[model samples]
Target chain A: MDNLNVLDIFKALSNETRLNILRWLREPEKNFPAQQAHLPKEVSIEGGVCVGDIQEKVNLSQSTVSHYLSLMQKAGLLEAVRYGQWTYYRRNEETLAKITKFINEEI
Target chain B: MDNLNVLDIFKALSNETRLNILRWLREPEKNFPAQQAHLPKEVSIEGGVCVGDIQEKVNLSQSTVSHYLSLMQKAGLLEAVRYGQWTYYRRNEETLAKITKFINEEI
Candidate 1:
């Protein structure tokens, strides 16, 4: 995340669904309550939601959601952690803060 | 610029050239010094540069640059003002500040 490229970030965010997904991740507890209810306590990570849960919420195919999440992760906008067979994604606040700084001071 | 859409802002910034154009506009006097040298004093607006001058520096065809500028203007990232026959472009700081706030708080 050292050299975060603006074009990559922008490209990752260009899609409306991707933007909504990022915003939803901001308040996971509120936005993903249903998913949280069924998740085993052992598998849960604060602010992190499983890929299946995200796909369910977005109503997109698993592959599509995975692709979007991968793009976001590549852009340093989201961090993905694999717990067993499932991948959980959470917003990368450090990178997000850097992006805000970039917007304020750079472009 | 009441309802600044995040998706639109991201779309406007998705291209490398457009991103560079926005960054270059940040320090127009330094980046576009050659264009400034020959401009008539009467046509100068603080922080504003003509479309032709911007196109020359970008090395893009006039229409392509205009399309990019128009898209940026529509997204509220830029302001376009017509001066006689030439259109002047400048960063819309107010909208830019709003976008930064959106990134920091909303997203």
Candidate 2:
């Protein structure tokens, strides 16, 4: 992505909670509960974890976590997968690599 | 700096103007005017640019520029040196290196 869009990513990552979310998503299996018990089989662990589980893990209000996830998604830091009524969130590793490259060479 | 302080740095850098300021300081000689013309020799261009010059370059009010510089200093993104009546600001290269490492390893 361009520098301006990368600035938006930085803005999204400015918040501590949002930053924590991104870190946690980097290691999904460790952060969230088992899928068969907490999520449907179709929503595999590799795909992502449900928003409600993330809300519970973060101990924030559902809307707040939802908002943070949406902001990260907009910045291309995270990807949201819709399966039935549940919205699963996962880190966009490729975009993250781009961010790392931007930091290394640009800012 | 710790992860928490790094988050504060990210918060300080969230603004476009603030981020631009950091990038400009990366090449101070290129971005600001010569010291002999605008500032005293003892002030030393290597130390930093006078806050007035930064304000002029940013096209913002003195107080606004001062506030941004102060915030950046508090976050360890910039260092402020007081020479006579002028406060000169420059990039904290060491702290920036630490931030880059943090992003590489942590988040």
lDDT of 2 by residue, B8-79 (tens): 787887788888888787777788886435555554647477788788889988899999999999998889
Docking class of 2: medium
Q: How much lDDT does each candidate structure score?
A: 0.85, 0.79
Kindly report which residue stretches of model 2 are placed more than 4 angstroms away from their true locations once superposed. A1-4, A36-47, B1-4, B36-47
Which parts of model 1 have CA positions greater than 4 angstroms off?
A: A34-44, B34-43
Which of the numbered candidates is closest to the native, going by highest DockQ?
1
Q: DockQ of candidate 1?
A: 0.82
Expressed as tens digits, the lDDT of each residue in A1-107 for candidate 1 is: 34997788889988988888899999987888665554578757778888888998899898999999999999999999877787889999988899888888788
Minimum summed lDDT over a 10-residue window in model 1 chain A is located at: A34-43
Tens-digit lDDT track of model 1 for B3-107? 887778889988978888888999887888665444577757667788888898899999999999999999988998776687888999988899878888778
Q: Estimate the lDDT of model 1.
A: 0.85
Q: Give the TM-score of each candidate.
A: 0.91, 0.88
Q: Which pairs in model 2 have colliding backbones?
A: none
